[model samples]
Target: MKNMRDKNSTNSGFTCANCGRTVSPAAKTARNHCPFCLWSLHVDSVVPGDRAADCRGKMEPVALFQKRDEWTVIHRCEKCGKELPNKCAPDDSFEALLNLTALQQ
Candidate 1:
């Protein structure tokens, strides 16, 4: 699968499927995950925002990992058990990221 570090699509914000929170667009890139809850959908297969995957499973944020100075969110698909790491957006909740990291300790 092709790994896209930055999502370059311009799409409208979506409501969170996990927490039912209204999520706004990231303003700079495609909002693949909900910033409020840090949850994502299994929509992309090869490239980010490609929407080629048919799993459509609810992706729960399992953990957070850092590469150098950047943080990435690790999501696990509840339906298909697929795991993917997503690049963190600038406005993503810091507290939520902290909580996810705390789980690893």
Candidate 2:
């Protein structure tokens, strides 16, 4: 769970398992994402930051949120209860994504 945060702020990443988009890290931190299916590797090393985790988990999209300005994707571990936020990808399935949002609403 080391190096889990950018600026030590609860650690975060741009391309997490939920958003398979290719992303640019702010600097040198690890960018999390599969760049295809948006499935995350079980990286339970930091709760949400750092590549220190050995879990290398497969993060599955479970929920969605319609914030004032952003639509955050909530992902739950296939093996754990941990959750994280993910930015939507352009290639994300519109139908599936809409269904997820519909259920949330």
Candidate 3:
């Protein structure tokens, strides 16, 4: 059997480590970060949902960018300093995204 942490089975709800919010999985995509704080755990090493990483660090949202109409959130691992970008979900907090944008400007 495949592990629950594997790429195909990682779409599950989790509590936000940064904001303490009880987050639900995304409706159309696999939820990887806290929508409220835009924080994530460093669980994937190569690809999103892979769960192959062993660092298990807190990924902090540090930047934001846009490509066409989609917005992406950049997260940096606090423990290892690895950075990754994730696409914004439909339900992600607009206020949090705005804060990131302000910091970039």
Candidate 4:
């Protein structure tokens, strides 16, 4: 079996699947979504940074929610219909987050 706690799990940059923008890795945490469009991929099965999923679907930013001071973006998979929440990155577009927040209200 493969090592589950491998240190080789890198926080690498990737091209946005939804917006086609080049995304850089986050400074404090593993970036699972695009900071430009706030879109993500269904790559993790149960936890963050665990690339154990095989869905490979485009995750659409559906809603925004807050817990105290921090905000999170809820992404829904287009192919598998799974919903996941990712914390907002510092470099994420404030305008886009506002738009999602407005839509939720």
Predicted structure with the largest lDDT when compared to the true one: 3
Name the 10 consecutive residues with the lowest summed lDDT in model 3. Answer: 1-10
Task: Report the CA-based lDDT of candidate 4 relative to the real structure.
Answer: 0.83
Q: Mark the regions of model 1 whose C-alpha exceeds 4 Å error after superposition.
A: 1-10
lDDT of 4 by residue, 1-105 (tens): 133233366477788889999887688888889988899988887886777788979999999989999988989999999998888888999989988988888
User: What tens-digit string does per-residue lDDT give for candidate 3 at 4-103?
Assistant: 3455578888888788898887888888899999999998898887788899899999999999999999999999999988889999999999999999
The residue-by-residue lDDT of candidate 2 on 15-98, one tens digit each, is: 544554544443433335443454665564554444555555677767877678766677667776677776565445577677
- How accurate locally, in lDDT, is each candidate? 0.83, 0.56, 0.88, 0.83
TM-score for each model = 0.86, 0.52, 0.91, 0.88
Error of 4 at 102 (Å): 1.5
Ordered by lDDT, highest first, the candidates read 3, 4, 1, 2
Higher TM-score: candidate 1 or 2? 1
Q: Which is superior by lDDT, 2 or 3?
A: 3
Report clash pairs, candidate 1.
none
Q: How far is candidate 2 from the true structure (C-alpha RMSD, Å)?
A: 6.4
Task: Compute the lDDT of residue 68 as modeled in candidate 3.
Answer: 100
lDDT of 1 by residue, 1-105 (tens): 122223444366777889989887677778789898899989888666787788889999998989999889989999999888889999999999999999999
Query: Candidate 1: worst 10 consecutive residues by lDDT?
Result: 1-10
User: Candidate 1, after superposition: displacement of residue 100 in Å?
Assistant: 0.3
Model 4 TM-score, all chains together = 0.88
